[model samples]
Target: MLNPPIPLNEMDRLLSLSDLDLDYAAHQDSFKDLTKLAAKVAGTEMSLVNLIDSYTQWTISTHNLELEQMPREDSVCQYVLMGDGSFEVEDLSADERFKDKFYVTGGPELRYYYGIPLNVNEHNIGALCVVDKTKAKELNPEKIELLKIIAGEIVNRLKYIKVIEELKSNLSEAKQTQKKVAHDIRGPLSGIIGLAQLISAQGEDNQMDEILEFMSLIHKSGRSILDLADEILSADNKKDKKTPELKGNEFNLLVFKDKLDKLYTPQALNKQIKFTVNTSLASETIPFSKNKLLQIAGNLISNAIKFTPVGGHVIVDLNLITIDEVQHVLQMRVTDSGVGLDEKGIATILGGTASSTNGTGGENGYGFGLVLVKHLIDSLKGTLNITSIPGAGATFEVNLPQ
Candidate 1:
């Protein structure tokens, strides 16, 4: 028995096939209708949409036959990938290439075959084929033209599936990020309230110096929060700018560090947890989105303070390390001495699921903060590492490009 020859562009063809991420099971009905139409038009007993990969011929869709997959060397449709047009065999018994094959000689004793290459992105990855047990002369010039049109439709459907899959993924990411940003606003708002209470108490004692300092910090934090909210609202109102929240701009890291310290210090002191923000930096100016960094760092510090018991320490260490001559990476580490995470709890956090647990001070959380942090890290093309023991402590390390 003669086997089908491999195409010269086999590597590229397989790569393109895998990139489609085709889920044949989900779209079986779509392919089934097309294959059914091809068989009806060609007056054949069976039809197949066979996708050829490195070693297997996958029957993604079929009509009038029950088939799944087979070796590439044993597939009659593999030969269609060698040319740019249809491959037809009027009588399998008379053709040397497939005359002694299983389907032709033993299984179905198929005598007629007509196939069109499924072309996409300058590659023929598969074939749309029809087969019969008799040497049929039913595929006229008009019928062949109709079959080619159907072949184009199959490729179009594949392209549509890729587009839809991408859209769904982008939509999901946007929704998750938005939720994280909304939750982040609560941090600064709480800080604002704390500062106001402090100012009122200082006013009764006529401590103008401290009151003025607190007012300055409040103004800056309020402006930053407003800017973040405006960006989010603009992105929602403007359908074109779907991801404006991720846009980057130049900002001073020192200013950001001060805001973070002011925001979390009161909360930590209220809980009797020692919160320290340590920074070792060669440059304070970083070309990255300030709001995104704020959200990431805010969530980490908040979680640390929440989990640590009274008299425990929660430290935030930040530094800029050289990645190359032209690039630097911002490394932020948050460590806490409190009830740490087990392996299962770590998995739930990293898996982007909500895992609710009460804090050492009985503080409640939505449990999606870590999930949001992970998604934001991925979006920034950064890395996150977590280390913890059940009762000792936990440390979260994040490195982002600047």
Candidate 2:
């Protein structure tokens, strides 16, 4: 059913290979002219120099209504292979070998057939099949000699097309290489961006305020570089070729919350905002990479700080939850008591999705962080959730299996 019976007339299926050459001619300059010359020289309605493969007969050049290609079993060229010289059927229906063939009855009602094999340099590529609906003009020795000469030129064209395709492939590869280089550089570039922000925000002041700003820059820039590097390195795994090793370790949520409070202090001061960290659960330990865990916290904390207004308070609470009725989890709630996010932002943060938007202070970041955070949490067998009021603030919760 891949190629349901392509009905060609006796001549169409026979020399109607003309369409093959015509269709492909535009694609390759090497074989195009040869097909046209083969048709004109034979004075046929359709003609083609074909390349017979295992299952299909393809044309290098074609003229008239012949097909671009057809199944070898269905091809008139397949029948022509039985003879040495041009296989000529002045009238196919009257011929014993072909009268029973489907094409003579309901298919492209082919009546006349003639094809001169184009074997050259040990390659039996195809034939210069000159076909017509009416009886073909009887070929004399002179015409047969001319057919041989024309077929030779067609072979030369095939060689040229092969070379052209090779060149096109090389050009495509080079372009992809250039695109990959640009994509790889985005990671390191983010580091530079963070450094630049620290310097600019400092405004030539070597004061404690400027140094703290610089430190926050280092934190953000370092995390961004690591995330980018991780993605670049894990791309092979993401492509389904390998499994990524899960990375985690034992750490305290209380201490982690304290670090966030300190890191976000500069941000809070800059916006004249109040930042708070509160927890009612017992301070316990859990297994997860501290550095990566910090990033997950940093991304959420930074986002909270970014959206929170001056004098507005951001509360971070660690809640203990039971998981699988077997163990306990130290879930962290980072809630910003300022302007909240839309449903879309909540989905992105919880689901690790995407969008393009600058922070409140014109801070630019690739929203891919949320996506990475989601993958990391899942890798650690954890669930993340986000809740928010339009003008109040947002609350993000992380639930992990103990």
Candidate 3:
């Protein structure tokens, strides 16, 4: 028997199939009645809903015969996937392509066959086929039309399954984002609580200026926390596909640097990595999204520290250049002396694929932060440049409009 020709878009078809994660057996009930109707309409003894994957032809649902899953090379359904419409053999034993010694010659002595490709999202993934032991002169036109309609229904069911799968995947990603948001808020919240504790401990013994300074810091940090909630953690943003508004507020560079120092200094120390920050800005307060900057800086520095080996150095440089009266370009560079990424690792990060890698100091991290950083940069209409040499060091430079 002749083998089936492979489709030109085989790689893409397989990728689409993998994303569906189709298990026809698990969803057999959905197609059982349809398969039965298809067999009865086409006057065949057996009918099947078969999916051809990279390695196997899986009969997800069957009528009047046992469910058979065989290697793709051995299954006739593979031929249907290569075409856009139905395929037929009036007598299997009469056709060279299908006149095999197994089913066609001895087992069930299958004679007649008809099948239509099951197309999903423009890719022919499988087939809806009917087989009979008796030979037929020709296929009935009316029956073929009815079978095509049934195949369409089957395709609809597959589309529904795909939608459900996508929703589930999106829900999972949302949960992960929620966890990261909570983790992000924890740092500023802890600083707030610590400031409160200090004010309580000093009581009336502290001077008015000292108390006012503590209160001012608390207010700035509190505003930053609120901004995180309103922007990053908003429920409305999730429902809509548009980018979240990166609103500009009067942001203090000194405060931003202080916050980063408070959050990452101890983390660096714990890992025995030296951390340093240098700033050269036109003004202490500028028009920009403080929360977005914090996210961009926090994710970069944390990743730098995580990947930096013991005794290595992580440095962040903040430089702002005034362009016009209303616009300023803030350039932030994060450099790390760590185990840098190879080409594959860089490609994976740039592709926005979530992956986990063990750090140089043995810290474990899912690369979600890098993905978030990319998103924020894109939302701000900014640019990011990366340069790295594996086993030596890496640098991440971001230029954002303020």
Estimate every model's Cα lDDT from 0 to 1. Answer: 0.76, 0.60, 0.74
When sorted by TM-score, best at the front, the candidate numbers are 1, 3, 2
Whichever of 1 and 3 has more lDDT, that candidate is 1
Q: Quick one: ranking by lDDT, best first?
A: 1, 3, 2
Supply the TM-score for candidate 1. Answer: 0.50
Runs in model 3 deviating more than 4 A are 1-30, 53-55, 81-83, 94-96, 120-123, 137-140, 204-402
**Model 1: per-residue Cα lDDT at residue 231:** 80
Each prediction's TM-score versus the true structure: 0.50, 0.37, 0.44
Residue 86 of candidate 2: its Cα lDDT? 66
Q: Candidate 2 — worst ten consecutive residues by lDDT sum? A: 1-10
Query: Positional deviation of 199 in candidate 1, in angstroms?
Result: 6.3
RMSD per candidate (Å) reads 21.8, 27.8, 19.6
What TM-score does structure 3 among the candidates reach?
0.44
| lDDT by residue for model 1 (1-402), tens | 333476777656655675675543346676899999999999998899988754446688999887766545567888899989899889998978778777888867889999999998889989999999889657789999999999999999989887876676678577758956866885777677577667766776886877777676776777677677768756666853442233223335566578677656766876788998887766554434343675578668778877899999999888878778668888889999999989888777677664656678765443445766787788789888889999998999999887
Q: Candidate 1: minimum summed lDDT over ten consecutive residues — where?
A: 242-251
